[model samples]
Target: MGGERGSIVHRITKRVSQEIEEDPNLVLINKKNADQADYLIGGGITSFDTYIDREKKDNRKYCTKGVFVSIRYQLVDVKTKEIVYTEERYIDRQDTREGSAPHAIAVVSDDIDMLAKQIVDITRPHEVKVTERIYLVETKNKDFKTACKLAKKSENRRKAQELFAKVYADEGSYQTGYNSAVLLFLNRDFEKAMEEMQAIEEKFHTKEAQKALKRIQEEIEYQQKPVQETSLDSMYLRF
Candidate 1:
């Protein structure tokens, strides 16, 4: 895999591997890990087309480039030797760009990323507990109250996160800020979490917030993957 087409092969493997590993029910392994990988995902470019529309106006040349790429990939159950899942994903991008070839290539990678996420969604999903401390401090902030209620159930945690973020914005207390960052971390929004943690450190300079920042950094180092899928599941009852 050396030519333009070959460039997509590595992207497909990498994107798919990362998304599949995010599933709490699956473990990702390669030559470096133990020989326990139970599924094989593979495929190639199913179809693609690229075109550059150029026009001359007054003396300057205008270019509107377009790219359409489709790739077909699959997940094969290794033990029983069966093709459990397969999908065809297509990406189209068109705009004036510095180069047409690179645009087309990037479109392929983007399409592969979308495909990988859909595969992750369809994989045998099992929810896992992610340990996080939500601040239940008595607050006048309505968002805080709503977050506490929503966080009681695992399925509502994502929505709870949005409210927690609002609480942090309204009241920049350490507890509020930490709660907000943990929600972002739980949702696997590491970049946003990092930003929020940095803000917390700058404002409060507290040790607890710093430690939370360190945990977030470790997760980023682990390839934007969660170290574990611990949950706030039913823990609100204890409080």
Candidate 2:
């Protein structure tokens, strides 16, 4: 809510209402106009922060350019006062050309609007595409091919993981090793994935291997975080 004349809260509310009105199953009547409704959605921006960095030329400060906008939001049922969703999002952009502080602030405001659109997408129904890969080692061994095929299937993950491990041990193909690590990651075996990727990094040291290793390390760190309870009380108390 703490924004310029084009407030983030107003932008988000207008966009969400427009999107909901387009849905055949939903209607958006103003609170004052409607006497009663089946449900009410209510929430506001909890926090809005912006950062701008000034460019430096030969140790002398030049013009401002880079900007970052972070916002925390929540959605709640007005009748029950229960929070249905909450999230914090950040957007950043940089421009090398000389610009004033107001120019950088304007860029950040645009980014906030874009972030609001993304939040609206989350509240609406949409389809998402999932991409996956299975490595194919150049070999005549039919068992290895079968394992690769099985590994691509969601239901046979465990069996496929065991088979891929066996293939990695026998063939010692860097491709197979990478595939094995990927399978371990998909199965939530982060430690094994890290070990396999680390081995690959030591021997091959390929860019692909390094990236995968970094990704697996991040996943391991994320999994180690403690789970927290989600409730309206927490949402209201946070700000």
lDDT of each: 0.63, 0.59
- Show where candidate 2 strays beyond 4 Å: 1-133, 228-239
Backbone clashes, each candidate: 5, 0
TM-score for each model? 0.44, 0.47
lDDT of 2 at 183: 78
Q: Number of clashing pairs, model 2?
A: 0
Q: How accurate is candidate 1 locally (lDDT)?
A: 0.63
Best by lDDT: 1
Deviating ranges (above 4 Å) for candidate 1? 22-24, 31-35, 98-102, 125-239
Total colliding residue pairs, candidate 1: 5
lDDT tens digits, residue span 143-225, model 1? 88888887765567789888877766776667867877887877668799999989988889988788989888866764433
Write model 2 residue lDDT over 1-239, tens digit each, in one string: 24442354565556556555655655665556433443444444434444456666876665545555555555544455543444466656665444455554455556655664555443442321113356766678776788777766656766877777787798787877787787787666779889988998999989888888887786676445443432111111100
The whole-model C-alpha lDDT of candidate 2 against the native structure comes to: 0.59
